[model samples]
Target chain A: MNRFKNNLTPYFFIMPAVILLSIFSFLPIIVSLGISFTDMNLRGLANWSTINFIGFDNFVQLFQDKVFLKSMGNTFIYVIIGVPMAVISSFVIAYLLKLVSDWMSTTFRVIYYIPSVTNIVAIAVVWSFLYNQEYGLFNYLLSLVNLDAIPWLEDPFIAKLSLIAMAVWKSNGVSMLIFLAALQSIPKMYYEAADIDGANRWQKLFKITLPSMSFATFFVVVTTLIGWLQFFEEPFVMTNGGPLNGTNSLALFIYQEGFQYSEFGYGAAASFVLFIIIILATLLQFKLRKSEDK
Target chain B: MDLKNNFERAIVNTVLFIGGLLVSLPFVWMILSSLKNEREVLSIPPTLFPNAPTFEHYINLFTNLNFDVYLVNTLIIVFFSMVGLLLNTMAGYGFGKFQFKGKEIWFAVVLLTMMIPGQVTMIPTYLILNEAGLTNSMTGIILPGLIAAFNIFLIRQFMVTIPDDLIEAARLDGAGELYIFFKLIIPLAKPILAVQVILTFIGSWNSFLWPLIIANEERLYTLSVGLALLQDQNVSNYGLQMAGSTFMVVPVLIIFIIFQKHIVEGFNVSGIK
Candidate 1:
């Protein structure tokens, strides 16, 4: 009895978390997959009898969905452009930070980090003002420089670019800090050896710094790519996937279908598609890394 | 050599200084614009500084827009942060220190689920909550996120580094399991605990999508939801929007400033590993 009781102690410690995750995390994944096959809508939500197993119809319609296809295309564009921009800019900023005085580095790090901590709604509000067509900061500065006041968020193409720009700005700080930590972790002996060989700054950077931080770079790129793929909040708040659905993301599309339009089955199908894409992308990156290692 | 080094230092300093100002520009604009009257805010070739600073919009948010209620609702984040910290720490300690049947499997489950994007599970979670009659309540908003898998994993990673002799000695002393956890393990786990606290607080505070869905009623709205609704209702009211943004951002900025070291260190710990 005492041995049995002793074994039970670990379960007691872990029970609450297990219960929570079973309901919220594990169960939801299964339920979502189940729902994706059915024709669930507002009426279906109200009556279980109304929710019929519609087979692949939802997935079929989703592939035929122009807006959904556009959203998929837009998400790819975001990840493709935004991930590299964020990684490169953060790497540059982190490198520059290393060269500065400690006081300046600390102060600038805090300033750069403010956006990451600030709520997305607040960020959207501030950037919307900055992106305003008339009497806005960007256009006002443009006027001072004798340039055209380009519509930052007004044009469909520009709106996507605008959202990407804000996302990079908001997200750069955390990645910068990650890069900074990686930079700081490199041994000083490597740099000293390079200096003894009379290597220039560029050679040292490409040879020593970049190669050493490869794993950190990979981590940032993967995480950032995954994040941008699901990109929802910025476009949701700023444009509502608007100016002709140019900025719609798969995540936002799912939200619109599931919650806004009450087409739960269709949304679930779309979400599953997104989920598979994300997993595949991550696995593909790992494969690429492995091949490069060989 | 000295002159060249000084020149490089000067160039780096200038570049970083400009970058800092660019980063700060939007926030500065938000605060300054919030202080301006509507007319001044709309003026062409906008004024960098508010010529006539006013707090009317801020007053309006509290009195007319139910921001006070929103603020109270946001305190739910604090409540969940504390509860989540307790639950995750216990689970972490259990996984880190104790041997149990299927322990590796369960821990692997937690780690694998961490990679699943929250969006995939969001629809079913909402449906389940609706079935439980939790919709349009604070309970619904806080339930799904109460014990994050990532937090549990982070805490577990930290707690595994804690020495086994401490737990062995405490067990030999006839201390209860609960007593050992509350008294011995928690005190030693302060660094990770601090990291968990900041992460949970910032995450819960900034959370928008779940709260936006669950809190359909005005009084139940968190700050992010309430502010988003306000923006929707007042798209042209730049001053009012700026004031609302400022109010929402200031508390987080204050917390970030106070815990800057922990915040950076937390990212570093998560990133490198």
Candidate 2:
């Protein structure tokens, strides 16, 4: 009886989490998946029979859709550029911070990290103002420097790059903190050994510092890539996929299709496409980890 | 050799100081712009300091824009959601402490849900809330987000570190399961709770997408949605826009300033530890 009671206790404890998870997370995905196979539009919800089955039609349409294609392309550019910039910048910052005194280090770290901790929406608003075409601080400063006010958010190509810059500014600090911790974890013995070998700072950095942080490098890259793929907040709050829709990302595109256009079926299909891509990327990361372990 | 090392350290410090200033310039610009006259705010060379700092925009937010109403709404949602989070945490502790059949399967199911993007069920969720007549209500905002898979996973992982002997002692003292959780587990779990609460509060406070979608009434808008609208409301007024943006970030900024150490520790503790 005691043993049985022990067995029941764990289930009782986890039951609430199980219930909430089912309702909020699991139930939604299952519904989205089910709806993806059918031509379920907003108007058809009132009429049960109107929701007809359309297998892979939405997916095929998404591929052919021009805006969807552009959003996908923008998302790739964001990941490729934004992730590396954030990672390398943070690593260098963290490394430099490590050499400073404790108080100075902590103060600088806090300053760098304020953007990460502050509300993204607020940051987006401030950044949008900074990026405004006229009477904006960016352009105002440009005039002082004898340069023309390049359309930060008004031109398609410039808008995409602007979004990438905002993404890096908002996110680099968290990566900085991660890299700082990894830096601290590196054994002092290695540095001492490098010193004994008469290795200079640059040589030690390339041979010891970079190689020692391999795990952290991998973790940061994978997480940053995952985050960039789901880039929504900045574009939604700042650009709204405007200026020829150059700044629209996959996640923003999903929102646009579903909420703005009421293309629920097509939106669900696109969402799942993103879901599959994320899963495949995650799996590839895991495969790399497995091989490294071997 | 010592002189050379000191020289190198000085260079590193100088580089870091410059980098830190560049990183923080946007925030400094926002705060200064908020206090500046409108013309100065839009001027070329972007004055680094206000000629005459004023609180006109902050005053306007409360008097004309009903900023208080949104603040109250944000407070209401955050408070109630925290209450619900307490319940969820207790449930998480129970799951981690006790053993039962189907445990692995249920936990796996929870993990699986975390992988799915929130966009998938957003429409259905809106539909469900609308059908339940909860749209435009604070319940619409708080209820859906009260419990999270990530929070449960976080709390449970922390709980697993608690030794079993403590629970046995509480049981021997005739303490009820709920009593032990409330009395013992909670006190010990303060560190994790601090991290979770800060993370949860920041997340809810900054949540724009879901709130923008569900909240129809301007009065019910959180700071995030309110700041977004401030852009349109004060379209040409960069001063007011900066003021509103600065306002939106103040609470989070204060919290982060106070808890900087824990905030960094929170990230490291959650993952790398």
Candidate 3:
């Protein structure tokens, strides 16, 4: 009995958390999986009797859907552009800041991170003002250079680029600090050894710093990829996927389908597509990491 | 060589200073524009300083837009989220210190769940909440987010660092499991928990998409959702939107300032993926 009770103790401690995860995390996965194959919409959602389990119909339709295709293309663009922007810029900033004095670096880190923690709605609002056509700051600066005031959000392509620019600003802070931590962990002797060997900045950077930073690079790349694939909040607030669905992302498409248009089945299918992509990427990362360790 | 090094250092410092200014300029503009009147905000070749700082937009956020209620609503949700932190710390402690059946498998499940992005599960969660008759309630929004896998993983990592012997001593002293968790683990895990709560506070406070969907009813809206509404209400009212943004921005800024070190550390901890 005592042994049984001792064995039961950990289960008791973890029971509530498990229950919460079941209701929110684990169960939802299964439920969404089931929902994806059925025709569950605003009308059918009310009565199970009305719901149709049209096997793979929603999944089939999602492939042929024009808006879905556009959003998929847009998400690909976001991940492609946004991920490199985050990785490369943060790498450069982190490398440069590590050269500065401690106080100065910390100050800049705080400044950059301020946007990361700020409410997204607030940042979108402030950015919308800066991106405003006639009276905005960006255009105001442009006028000083005798240039035209470009429509930042009114044009489809430009709106996508604008969102990408904001994504870089909002995300780079955390990635930079992560890179800084990676930089600090590198052994100093490598740099000193390079100095003794009379290595140039470019060679030492390529040969030493870049290799050492690979771990952090891998981390930032994977996370940023996952994040950009779900890019919603910015476009939701900024463009609402406007200018002919140009800024629509996969996650945003899912949101509008499920909530706005009440196309829950379609939304679930799109979500599963994203889910599969994320899982594959993560598994690939682990596999690569294991092989690299050898 | 010395002169070149100094020159390089100076150039880097100047570049950093300028970068810092650029990073901070939008926020400065947000606050300054918040203080200006309607006409003043839209003036071409906008002045850095407000011609006449007015409280009208701020006043309108409360009186016209019903912002105070949303602010309170945000606080309530954050409070629930923070309360759930204790529950997370408890489970984390169990996973960290206790030897049990299926320990590795259970912990693996927690880690695996992190890979499942919130998007995939979002619809099912809404359905679940709707079935529970919670769709329009604040509980619907707060319940699904009560405890995240990330929080559990982070807390478990912190709890494992507390020497096992200390917990063993407590166990030997005739203390119950609950007592050990409450008295021993809780006190020692305060720093990690503080860092987590700060992150969760910002996360919960700023979360938009969840709040927007789960609580479509205006009264149940959080401040971020309310700010979005304020934006949509007057698409071109920069002054009003900026003022509303200020209220939303200020609390987060204050908390971030107070816990900047821990906040940065929290991001670092999460990056350990």
- Candidate maximizing DockQ: 1
Q: Evaluate every candidate with DockQ and list the scores.
A: 0.66, 0.59, 0.62
- Please report, in order, the local distance difference test score of every candidate based on alpha carbons: 0.89, 0.81, 0.86
| Candidate 1 lDDT, B74-131, residue by residue in tens | 8876688679779988999889999999998889878877988988998999899999
Give the per-residue lDDT digits (tens) of candidate 2, residues A1-294.
Answer: 776666676666666667766776777777788778878877766676899899999998999999999999998888888988989888988888888888988899988888887888778888887888886777877888889988999888889899889889888777888888888888889988888999888888988888777788888878887888899988888888887888999999988888888777888889988888877877888788779768
Of candidates 3 and 2, the better by TM-score: 3
For model 1, give the RMSD to the true fold.
Answer: 1.6
Candidate 3 has which clashing residue pairs, if any?
none
Off by over 4 Å in 1: B1-4, B270-273
Displacement of residue A76 (Cα, Å) in model 1 is 0.9
In candidate 3, how many Å is residue B98 off? 1.3
Off by over 4 Å in 3: A1-8, A283-294, B1-4, B265-273
Give me the iRMSD of candidate 1, please.
2.1
Q: What is candidate 1's CA lDDT for residue B109?
A: 76
Estimate how well candidate 1 is docked, as a DockQ score: 0.66
Better of 1 and 3 by DockQ: 1
